[model samples]
Target: MSQIQGWAAQQAGQPLVRSSFDLGPLGAEEVEVAVDYCGICHSDLSMIANEWGMSRFPFVPGHEVIGRVLALGEQAKGLRVGQRVGIGWTAGSCMHCRQCLSGHQNLCAELEATIGGHHGGFADKVRAHWAWTIPLPDGIDLPSAGPLLCGGITVLKPFLAYNIGPTARVGVVGIGGLGHMAVKFAKAWGCEVTAFTSTAAKADEARSFGAHHVVSSRDANAIQAIAGSLDLLLVTVNVSLDWGALLGTLAPRGRMHVVGAVLEPIPVPAFALIVTEREVSGSPTGSPVDIATLLDFATRHDVRPQVEMFPMDQVNAALKHLADGKARYRIVLEGAKG
Candidate 1:
């Protein structure tokens, strides 16, 4: 109803500055959230830099949002005012579409992204369709749960989609954000977990995150040593790696899934797949139901992203920290303070 305050990048590659704008009346199916905390995702940086060539200026970038309902439209359902909730990438969808009807709203042809052509959660307030605003479970620690909305769901969807079992030997490539969560999830699922990373320093840290073993992603010898051992390998980095060597690590009938938004083409030798009957796949964030399941799983297993906190006003510095690759894992912005 009043002017909503936020930080925005007025131009590509520029620092976010304080900005205020009107958020028209709430839609019938929309609910407004008073943001409490918002996770700074790499996707947010990409959007700010116009990396995908789809960004709009005066962009407010945040999608992994943790907040309380401030107001609800008359038609909003299943959530109450003042309820804690988390909103991820998908904000709204054509609810009558086959994808939406089948409970895969993330795949709807007309899905609305939280930060696409709209304001996101890096603000004092934000809004989303009721379906995408999921109530936080009682047990989840709100501060750390923000990343679960995006990075968590991105990695967790592969496990659900591939029917990964407790007995599966899972390898997680990259020891940052999504990769870290993959390790935790695999171990908690009763799988033998292996972490692959280029940085030697992160190996021990990866082990602490539930990785039973760690291997150098760039070392042919180390990568070769684990040949044919993993039932599933989840790649979470956005850079191209030695695909052939990584493929060799998969057991017969194993799968390599990419959750990261790698800009480069992945070169996979046909023989690599033919010889081992291996497969490659990728997925976006999970459906709303899947997010809820992930939250429950995290709560039951006591899994959460390791995070550093910054006030929303210091978003530019936080962005720079992530850009410099200094974030231990993830960063979260405490919403506008009094």
Candidate 2:
């Protein structure tokens, strides 16, 4: 067993505290990683607030982890000690399940999430399954790559799943963390990108992120002007909006993918789908394969998250900053010297 210091919440709605915890002996297929950086995710804030009410107390909340391998178990394969690696939202999944067999590991029924079902990356060190650890490219630093493990891949995989050609017209909704990345990726792919945001202040910021057009989704006229104009709309907002209005912006056979959490239902009119034969889908964080592909693509294209760094001991302040939407984008926690 190994003891390491980390920030954990003793109860829901409480601030995370720096404490020590035991990392049990590694299994044959597991390895111990010395965590270098961890990204604070919006979902982490939700979990800490117990919004979903499934939070496990003494919870160390983080899924976007970048680290170096400290030790590897005997059965661990293809990884070496001191290698730069990362752990995403998934710790492991049932390999024999249909979803896993089909390469849809994210949807596997037996999936073990990094922070939810298992201990996550907010610690100074963690034990992870070998299959879930991905090698970080030498080009990307651990701190910047931390958000890529979650926010970066969450938006990237959905675009990858679409597999659209370079000529595709991509529209990204919302201008926050995920939406900004979506714009950059879409533009880099040689697509004409449009940004949809409710806030007028975000228009210039959206274009700066490579969006070709910035439209206010709040204006009825603005919404109608883009009606049936987009080949793909990536809805990245967590709050519910008029799904029909957004759907109306999709071109024929165009799809709208919802990647954020809406606490309440979005009123979806059945006719909206029936008319254009359009589709709506949702996506979660990526699998290990997806993460690897994203990292490579990001490295090749110089795509990185805008981040604000915080010390590990100030995790509570970090979470509060995230909850308050005060961080410009992502908040990363760096380890403190003992």
Best by lDDT: 1
Candidate 1: 10-residue stretch with minimal lDDT: 329-338
Candidate 2 Cα outliers beyond 4 Å, as residue runs: none
The residue pairs in collision within model 2 are none
TM match of model 1 to true structure: 0.98
Q: What is the C-alpha local distance difference test score of candidate 2?
A: 0.84
Single out the weakest 10-residue window by summed lDDT for candidate 2: 329-338
Candidates' C-alpha lDDT: 0.92, 0.84
lDDT of each residue in 1-338, candidate 1, tens digit only: 64789889999989998899898888999999999999989999999999998888899899999999989999999999999899999888889989999988899999999999889989999889999999999989988899999999999998888899999999999999888888988888899999999999999999999999999998999999999999999999999899888989999999999888888899989998998799999999989999999999999999989999999988999999999999889999998641
- For residue 140, give model 2's deviation from the true position in Å: 1.7
Residue 190 accuracy (lDDT) in model 2: 86
Task: List where candidate 1 sits over 4 angstroms from the true fold.
Answer: none
Per residue, candidate 2 scores C-alpha lDDT tens digits across 1-338 of 57877788889888878879877778888888888888888889888888998789888888888888999999998899999899988888877888888888888988888888567888888777898889988787656888888888888887788786689888898988788888888888888999999989889988988999998878778888888978889988898777778889999888898888877877778888888888888888877789999999888888878889998878888888888878767889887531
* TM-score result, candidate 2: 0.96
Q: How much is the lDDT of residue 337 in candidate 1?
A: 48
